[model samples]
Target: MLLKIDVASTVPLYQQIHDQIILGLASGQLQPDEALPAVRQLADELAVNMLTVAKGYNLLKAEGYLISDRRQGTRVAANFQADAVFMQALQEQLHQLTAAAKIRGLDVKDVQELVAAQYQSFEGE
Candidate 1:
């Protein structure tokens, strides 16, 4: 897992970590039984404090996306799927994208065309 941290971004460091893990989960990059890097190790890799990684892990744990066991270490939660809240969050992000695109002068038709092209390109791969 390669994690690139942008310390200057407005997004909180913990959220960057959280979102990356969520993407990893969705893309099947992280397996259910896989042990995550120790929080300290992840901090070292990202050159951030252990607390940042721990905070992200805690959030994921609370959301039932991962589980932390002292003996077995931290692993993804088996059979986990996005809940209603997660889906709503995703929808909100999509809305933000559309709003931003419109603000940048992308008309509705242009936006739809762009999305269609991108969707087709994605499926082609």
Candidate 2:
């Protein structure tokens, strides 16, 4: 899994890590039961603190997106699926993005086309 971090972005480091992992999982770049790097290793790779990476891992574990064990290490949940809350969050984000686009003078058809394009771009990945 490749993760890109933008230190200058307003988004917090931990959230950035968490979001990228989620996107990886959604896009099938990550597999179920695939082990992620140890917290210290990931922290080193990202030039961040261990606790920062651990915080993101903990959040994912709490949401059932990951499983962590001292012996086996951290892995994607074997049966991970977006729950209702996850779906709702996605819908909320879409709503916000479409609203912003509308405010920027994009019509409904334009927004729909953009969404369709994005969805299609993810196909057969």
Q: What is the lDDT of residue 77 in candidate 1?
A: 87
**Candidate 2 vs. true structure, TM-score:** 0.85
Candidate 2 global lDDT: 0.91
Q: List the lowest-lDDT window of 10 residues for candidate 2.
A: 116-125
lDDT of 2 by residue, 11-117 (tens): 99999999999888878899999999999999999999899999999999988899988899999999967789888988999999988998999999998898888
Error of 1 at 58 (Å): 1.8
Best by lDDT: 2
User: Over 4 Å off in model 1, which ranges?
Assistant: 108-125
Predictions in order: lDDT: 0.86, 0.91
Candidate 1: lDDT of 38? 87
Q: Show where candidate 2 strays beyond 4 Å.
A: none
